[model samples]
Target: MNKPLIAGLLTLALAGCASSQPDQPFSLTVAHINDTHSHFDPSDVQLTLNNKTVYTRVGGHPRLLSYANQLHQQAAQTEQPFLLLHAGDAWQGSGYFKLNEGAMNVDLLNQLPLDAMVLGNHEFDLNNQRLSDFIDGVTFPIVAANLDVSQDSDLQAVENLTPYVLYAFKGDKKKRVNSVEDAGKYPVVAIMGLVLEDMANIAPNIGQAQFKQELVSAQQTVDTLTEQGVKHIIALTHLGLDKDQQLAEQVNGIDVIVGGHSHSLLGDFSQLGWEKNAPYAQQFTNPDGLGISCVVQAGKFAQAMGELTVNFTLDGQVTDCKGTNTLLVDKVFYNDVRRADKHRLTDTEQERITGFLAKQPNVALVDEDPGLRTYIDETYRPELLQTYGAVIGHVPSSLQHVRVPVANQGSQVAPLVAASQLYWANTPEVRGVSGREVDFALVAAGAVRNNIEAGELKAGHVGLDILPFVNAVSLVSLTGREVAGLLLETINGAIGDDTHAGQFPYVSGLRYTFNETRRGHGYLANIEYLHQGEWQRIIPDARYQVVLTGYHASGNDGWHTLFEAQQAETDRIDLAYVQDELTAFLVSRLSKNEQGAIEVHYQKQALDCQLPGVSCNADAQAFIDYVQARRPILTALPESGVTVNRLH
Candidate 1:
């Protein structure tokens, strides 16, 4: 906070009080929501309200509608104006959207009285025709300052859609009715919307639309809205939290930014003051640098609603801000003092949303012809069961499990995938590529997200529960030197002892050694790439192929070396490549077998032999101990070879 500017505002306020002596304060309420992503169903989310543990079931459209009505009523009682604004991504996700092409959620959203809503990345999941159809169903305006929807025929159907919406609310304080000539007071509020630029990159095939820099688009909208004689400006932003903060800092005319995408629960107010010409070409308009702004996000899955209260003087300058971004619970009766039971939902509430599909339109379409929802649900279930042979693996309850804490190194999950890759490679289809059965598969361990159960576990049970993220695989060719370089980078990024061979790439056909003490810079002094049970020093320019997830290939979390290596190969693979080729290859092999099962076994090589002079060592027994003790960890990996066999 700039103390000098605040002091100046205080002085101005005191001088105004001394002159006019204004008696009343004016306030209005803005209720906001974002990243709902079609999770209209209520969620059991925990919150700390007034320093008390409040278990509130939040965010169902019906529940939200009911709460909005209640809040509107309260506002009416207090003679204050209330506006409901949705930040973005009110569509997509869940079985509901997949089943109905997002029309069901659009219908429900239309029922609510909203001032305006912004477009999010997921809104473009379907083509423009479907998006336009959904928008046609909505009663209120949808704005996107950045997206050029004009080029699309379907999007152009919504003629009334504006880049920014200007709302006029009656300000507090009764006007004198002298001589029947006095007019009623009215306060105009302006709202604008903007989408992030990265939508083109992330949601590429969904829509061929592009978004401009968030700050630039917002500035343009501000100029337009301000020129129309509206002073108070609120921005409905779909650009995530970080971008929202940058907007707050870079954009001058914006008063508050209701952001989405990243999914945050923000209650604290953020203030930014103008210091002459701020960075990013922003020119200050507010006098005395007293301008205050805030940015908030109400997580994903419609789990929360954000409400804000701002007070402005008759002169159109905001003087104060109060209240909070309260996340209203769906179950209203739970907080009722008169209720005998603490739980709000009657048995009827539980079943209420479950049968909502019956009343929803296009339900028959999804039921008859399921889309992505059906494919994903069907694909994962059967495939998970076939990957790991054992129906269940039991472990002690006390064993603790977790995701790989390190970024580049192999995790329990990476090794399992590496093992599966090796096992799958020996199949006929892949064997043809190398003209050899196969030797091993190497995987970095950092890809794992969660831990497995400590107790008895099943094959489908573990893989399904553990590796839930939908990531595509990419296969790349590299030389022996490149592999060694990649291994060096991987080892250097590891957290624990690197001398333990098991700690390196979870390998099926490869073995390597590293000196823990010497494994800092130039750590990987030497490595042996194993093929068909024979170890050989890698040739610098020799072409070697390896498979990894698209995320790793893209190097999103900063595996630049891996990304560069993949780029060097120029063999970029789509997600469908692995799903269809490698997965199918494994399935075909498993189906022909009598038992239809694949076994994953691990054996640790002693580091003393590989590391030579280095004393660092972990024997086969030690590795077995690590796997058994960390069964929860070992099970976290994605198991391969689940198949759907047609019964003859």
Candidate 2:
């Protein structure tokens, strides 16, 4: 054979071998968002640098949509096979959900071209009927393989809900095939859904719906999909990041996982201008040591969109993957202003320019997407603005609602919430018995979502941020020893190593010193409580009634002792809705005078000190009075009472 002929034949032979290989690589792109929490309107978010609040105003739904659309368009231009997924929690958090019963969220979310979304715990917040209605309204599939909805007729009838879905992607149609039989070659992608197994414990509206263990459900799904000749499989999970990571390691065939629930922001930290964490596409070796699975989660509140480009072998194994959890910056306005400046500038344009210039001295001005801006203004802004303007009360100074143990003390907001709960628990109308008082009140740090900013506090702010959950305030009786044990357990389980724990105890009439360096039960020291107007060390056997949210009283968040104590009718007293109770408490304080002019008296007392200066009254009046008198200054409890001996 001639040299040219030999070379051509060799090339043809190599191509034929490559086509026959099962390990051939194919690429697919996944764009996802999670835990939006009904925050449709753009709100001010404090941007932090090195754990310091650098500036505010970072995200909005409009900008998020614009960024997602841009990514979709780019994928289309590149002719890349892509899928858009929402990992869940599309309900609750904002006033929009409360106003429209998640109708607005469903409507707005329907506008996005999503392939699928896993059911989040919050989806059950409105009960099965509404959840079924919301599911019916959506155009895309709502998948959750582990949810046993047979008991719920409405949920069982949801036509769009499924266990898993398969998406087929045909290879390049333009590529010439020598044989007609070989023309339809392509890869099939299968995605399975798993919800948090503890849904019923967190969202009671789930009722009889049961959730299977994530590992079991995921493994079974993967096995089924694999047996059906599907090589590439993904778990569209609503399990938080920690569970997702565990799932990745435990499951055999899960090629990738898009997760939510923990509201984790995964990816290159430096690019997002936030704390460092796992890369957007975090890889984990399968338990069998045969393959690798990747996991990604977009942060909550439309703050970022996770973009993952994954390549898989023909046999359905992940070969390569890359991408990031892209932050949706409000840079679109810069161009808008530039374009407007070239023409006759309108009043809005002038105002935008002025605001942009003002941020220039310390922070950079990033513009939001005009399309999202218009949507918020025309569709969502009217009611939201009214709520924002409806002033509930005035705060003399900013009450800092930091979640971390600032100076070894818990959040100021937590105590305020606890005090409110305690006040309601003592009221005959709320307590149901005349002249009854809870011995102490406890509020979880996570329950208090946002801080009361120094200024006019509005009803909308409270509804949208402060008291977002609809949990009822409940009272439970426990022995002083049990109470002390519950506190110790909370610190050990939830507040491990002195890191920020949402379950961290914030009390109205309890004081305890926490040793950060100590392990297990030893973390707590010098536990004390106010009894009969005196600071007294807790008597181990003394029975004391405690006021807290029903969620907490049920022994959720590692409080099994409290749960055991709340089983008795005499021990447990369920009060009114927590939001309504808190609102009534604030209203009561505000109505002290015709002008609603009331002073909040929050004494700067140490966490370990005996009810210092009589300011440890543990009532709404104390918080109200403190706010009325302390103008402009952020309230910090005196550090003397609760001291931290170890390095944080």
Candidate 3:
């Protein structure tokens, strides 16, 4: 890890050397924004200055550009060198960025005087080459220590980019009486980038061109910069707060690590000091040799800006520092260009969003319904309509519990998901295009987020509760023997062998059965695989195409065998895509049946068991209680601290 020192020593050499002046004390400002996601509309801004009633639009290139300019002016007046930095995940998310493929945000970012940019996982969603192209259009140097972009076609030139950068400012020097007054090089502000290894696991498809490991790569970057005498080190890290804390523990000499990814709005800017004498030196409140390492991450979006002032000396060392994380709000008036009459709601959404922002509480009094404007703008605002593809159906009943499958039909959970996958794979235009039809689909009952409700929820709520997190459908190629092995593992892990074998699939396209004591795995006796309409023995070496969400494929919830055996590769279909497909399938089913109900049924198997001295029910209940009580560790969140129920 102690590598990459060769390039850190030299960054810039001026053509003309001015005589070195007396060492003077000066201030420098390091400012940054994260997760803007192209909400450039004036409506996104909010302000809460003390007793100042202001209803101003927020979060667009124009507004941000203006704020940046103001900061630059303030820096000049205060004799502090100012530097602008972005932590990461800046290019994707909102309507505008999606519509124009990040052009608007890119244009806006370049318009501001940004010194450096850090690469986030989302930036790779367009694939490595396009990501490189996007980076090329930016004026600042992009820094990421763990991303190996050398192999990418568009980013090869930028691979050799130093993980840390030093910016030096030349300013007038304050002199003591009779002391030689000397102009000083700009305060050297050091920038470094770090990303979590799991970032690859979570955003696999987008991050295929890169690899991430936070601690090791970050330490190397820091050591190199510290050796080069960079005064203040700022980590523009996209690895989230916990990972940032871990980095602070393991590495030393870094002054500040600005973080992102986990959007936490802590409400203020504060410093965390690692203790010098604590057993875990890294997490200590104060470290013996190192000055406190200040870590800050403003909540996501342009919701806030983090400002830190580091006081240092002529020899490149920090003396003392204090600052605040400021919440930026609109303080002026803008015209309402969001009227639906101006253009089609969808067509003018992105532009209109700027005009529709809600008047934040305690800020100003421009409009009462600030949220409505945000909603309208977001739904229609993005220049592109790419977010519409993914939709999923919701069922009211909890699907977690199992029951008997219908005489002629199969498990409802199985079939419903199967139908969705089939629909996703073979649409009117996509059927048999690549000689691959999702022959089989698999979903663990545990993967279902919750019972879909009968009534509708907010679009965001549905996305959050049903889909929860982002996951794509991964197509994995597996042999029948491998499939059988997976099934055997499942059976062994289940309550008992008497439980049905097909139960594990929680899917409808295929079926199989097993007996507990009568047969070994029941594969030799009742094992059967169904496809189309007939029975087929799952050939061990015969390759079968299977579909599963990306989470399982990545072994997120204990699916290591599937990951290893099936050779899973995410097909790049996010959960939103599955949600959309489900919605379409439900609609189609509703139209065909006319009843408008998508019902899924599962067969509950009755297992025969004997406890030497206890009733089966009582024995099972006791055992459950024992296990629940003895569980080594638990982390469960309760809705409330107290509960009340009517007694019968």
For candidate 1, lDDT tens digit of each residue in 378-452?
643244335434533343221222222232233444455555555544446545543444334455454442333
Q: Which digits, one per residue and each the tens of the lDDT, describe model 2 over residues 200-265?
A: 666759866889888898889888877666677889998899999999898888888999998888
Predictions in order: lDDT: 0.51, 0.65, 0.48
lDDT of 2: 0.65
> In model 1, which range of ten residues has the least summed lDDT?
583-592
Off by over 4 Å in 1: 1-25, 44-58, 171-185, 206-210, 267-288, 328-648
lDDT of 3 by residue, 1-648 (tens): 010111221222222233243266656677777766555554322122332222334344445555566666687677556777788888665545546675665655666667777877777666666676677777677877777766655667754344666555543111111111111333455677776566555553553356656777877777776565455677788887777776666677666777777654434221111011211112212233555566666555565566667666665455665554444544343222221233223435433333432322111112222443454356545423343332222222223222222222323333444445545544443343323566666665444433232211223322333333444444556677766666555544432434433224444344455344432233323334557767676776787776666455444344446645423232222122221222111100001125732221112221112323212221112112222333112111111111111111
Off by over 4 Å in 3: 1-13, 18-23, 42-58, 159-161, 172-186, 206-212, 268-288, 313-315, 330-648
TM-score on alpha carbons, each prediction: 0.54, 0.68, 0.51
| RMSD after CA superposition, every candidate | 16.9, 12.2, 17.6
The TM-score, computed over Cα atoms with residue i paired to residue i, of candidate 1 is 0.54
- Looking at candidate 2, what is the lDDT of residue 243? 91
Badly placed stretches (over 4 Å) of model 2 are 1-24, 48-54, 170-184, 268-273, 332-369, 388-412, 416-457, 468-504, 508-510, 514-524, 528-648
